[model samples]
Target: MTKEISFIDLGLSEEILNALNDLGFTKPSPIQAECIPLLLEGNDVLGMAQTGSGKTAAFSIPFLMNIDVNLKAPQLLVLAPTRELAIQVADACAEYSKYVKGVKVLALYGGQRYDVQLRALKQGPQIVVGTPGRLLDHLNRKTLDLSNLKGLVLDEADEMLRMGFIDDVESIMATIPEEHQTALFSATMPAPIRRITKRFMHNPKEVQIKGTKQTAPDIDQSYWLVRGMRKNEAIVRFLEAEDFDAAIIFVRTKTATLEVAEVLEKHGYSCAALNGDMTQQLREQTLDRLRNGRLDILIATDVAARGLDVERISLVINYDITLDSESYVHRIGRTGRAGRAGRAILFVDSRERRLLKNIEQTIKKPIPEVALPSKELLEKRRLAKFTQQVQQQLESADLEQYQTLLEQIQAESGTDLETIATALLRLAQRDRPLILPPDPVFKPAREYRDRDGRNGERRLRGDNRESPKRRERRDVGEMDMYRIEIGKENGVEVRHIVGAIANEADISSRYIGNIKLYETYSTVELPKGMPKDILKHFERVRVLNQPMKMSLVAGKSSEGKRGRKSNQPESDDKGFAKKRGRPTAPKF
Candidate 1:
């Protein structure tokens, strides 16, 4: 039997090893252990590993040691599919090269001013990480010099291909010096990628790390199809309904971590944000609190949550799904450790269904679709918890002083002891409402007919046609009418509008009612109390590859201008009544 190798055994330089120790990395992941030695030997290498298999460290460490700080002019170039991934890769390289002085690492990508990238380029950074499109842009501008480059890396090669940047990637690769060492890392080796390796790489050493793509078998995985409900509200319901000792909710960006954590805390949840922007001290403190139970939720980005091992983290929520399928495995890997049962829940909108399908296929498992918990279910769970807590207090509490006080109050007020006790209970529970009021905007939830007219799972009633009288009576209250620019001419079906609104606004489809499509525009009726930010976000949503151009229709006259009563079935411009029950968007 062979033994596993540690990071120290990979024969890394003292400075690199010291930085690794500071970062608390005692061992290497399989890909890291395999590639580091070959990369150090000055050979072209190709690494195939899942997203979180430590691929960044595998390539970064060896290249960091080999780069010459004195002759710095973009010595090592890393190409990524997106700006986010580019920033992450650059950050990893910078951290690994902390003790190795005079080696500057810069990230160049779109959405930022060219002056910023140009300034960094003039500073003569030894390593550059950027997306294919932006890198080519810099190359064309002559701001970035590839003349002194020593090595090149194509990170997430498959992702770049999927994003239609393969041509740009090939062009950039052709511009780099042919004598430089090259490495390509991707989760999958498609035919194009294989051809690239054969053409550009010279006898490349292939290191394939397998079996890390699947999460723990004990982890129960499921997804919640978010419609018109706010993500925070849905998350709060989950926290209220589920029994979890600890949880980690994953978001896409650093800003999202703080934003989500703030919302959760405002709703009275014990949560903290973990992101790359935090100081090491703050990060350690947040993790310590999570470990000691002072924090119940740790909202984090993918990079911040790397190497996090907390046994009590029995729940993982993918609040914002990542584009990378391997990241899904990494996120859920936080739970179900050490032979313990765990749960992972993903939130997906209707548009991102394709990403969801890719993840399921990559992991080779079907994630069951779980319905959102009803308001009744959440209230029941809260009451049951309150009861358990009261029972525990009664069994162990020292009540002599309270009993005496209750007797004194009873005598003074001539009230029964039970009445005084009930008054005290109400005071204690007054801060948080025990029961949530029903929302009239939403139709009563029950078995809803899918667009196919089959009895599918519960759907919002707005998707179904209501008689004119029923709609007029049901929509009598404060309902706002909004108009969207896309209509029948652009394949603007009713299901498309409902699915987009429900998914984007995090609202349930049932709350969205009375969709009327015309030759050039469509009108939708929703509750009047919509949040401003949600309204703004809804406008930017694209339906059928066209911006919705959603705006308030303004006044009751606009509804009459459309010439449709609340109960009237939707019709085309020619006044042909559409089908009452329309099918929904096709599921991936």
Candidate 2:
């Protein structure tokens, strides 16, 4: 039988080893064990590993060891796909090099003020981590100097490719010194990544960690089909009935993290939000509080919660469904760690049923659909908890003073002891009543089963009649028609409109209604009362290389406007419509 390798056997420096010990890392993971030695030997390595495979440390440790802190130039550069991931990688590198003197790390990404990055760059940080677009921007502005680079790491290469940053990646790589060592890590290797490795690396060593994509067997997962209630209300009901030590609630956006955290805190849960917008110090403080049991629920996005391992997290709630199956697996993997049993609950919207099926196929297991806790069940649980509190107070608390006061009150008021006790209970539970209130009534969305016994919903086509039930449930009357300047003439299709709206607005396709395509413009029906910020964001969203200059139509419906050829202007020889007097834009 072979023995496992410890961090001590990896031949690391004392400072590095001390930092590892402080972090409580006794043994290296499989990828780390294999890549650390090769990386330290000045070799270009290609590693295949999933998100939580410790690949960050595998490359970080060797890069830190190889850099000469005396020369305060950029020696190690890591390019991640998202701002959240770049910040996480920088945080990890900073932790690993805490004991080493004169070593600094800086993360540069969009949404952060450029002045902050400029000041950090002036400080001569030896390590730089950033997204490819921001990195290219810096390179173009001559703000970053990589003349003496020693090592380069492409973290989550597949994700970078999927996000259309491969061109920016190749452009950045072209400027770097050819003699520098390279380490590329990804979950999957597509053709573009393979081509780059062949062109840039010099006889690279390959390391593949098997089974990283598999979900933990100890996790019991289920989904609650969002029907009759809003997501936040359903979450509160679930928490009222569930018995969990600690949990992490995953959302899709930074704004959502704050919103969900606020809702949970209002319900008297000890929770906090972790997102990329927060400073490094604030993020660390939030995490420390969670670890010390001061907080029980953490609301976060996927990137914010990456590589998080907490033993007390016995539950995970997916407040917003992930776009891909790999992320779904990673979200639930936060729980059920160290062989402890964990429970994961997913909140699925009606429009997301197809995504749910994709997740089931990836895991090769069925996630049973569950209903929200019944009002009766919640009432019983609350009463039981109140009773338990009373029992504990009676057994351990000193009640001699209170008992005398109670007797005096009873004697003066001429009330029985039972009546006084009941009155006191009412006073004690006034802020949080023991009895559950009536749940809000909402009409359930209908679903149609296809020939294959699969549940699905039809998308709104041009002028398709909607059933009265669906119309009332979805509030079709509240939707307003808006015109965009892309249509069949620009090679735009129905799927393009749906995909753009769904991805960019964080809105489900079900909410989008009739889409009519014309020669130069198209109109779509969207729920009214959209926030000004969301409207502003949509203007920047492009479809088929053209901005969706979206504007509200003059009337509520586009029924008559579609066939009004007399009101439409003619097109020029260049296939462009001539300018004409437009209707007054409506107020939001």
Q: Estimate each model's TM-score.
A: 0.52, 0.49
lDDT of 1 by residue, 34-61 (tens): 8888999998999988665677888989
Ten-residue segment with the worst summed lDDT in candidate 2? 451-460
Deviation of model 1 at 439, angstroms:
15
The sequence of per-residue lDDT tens digits that candidate 2 reaches over residues 1-588 is 214888899899989887765544557878889999999999999999866567888999999998798998899999988765676688679778989999988888765446557766877889999988888989999999999999999998998888778898999999998889999999899999999999999999999986434754568899998765557768998887788889999887787888888888888999999886788899889888888899899998876786788888989999888744667888898888877888999998655665686578667778998888988888788788889999998897688888999989999999999998898888888646777666544434445333110001112222112123232213233455577888776767676787677545544455676777888878876765555555666775656545698886633422232322224333222332322222222222
How accurate locally, in lDDT, is each candidate? 0.75, 0.76
Candidate 1 lDDT at 174 equals 89
What is the TM-score of candidate 2? 0.49
Show model 2 residue runs off by greater than 4 Å.
Answer: 1-3, 213-218, 222-380, 385-409, 416-419, 426-588
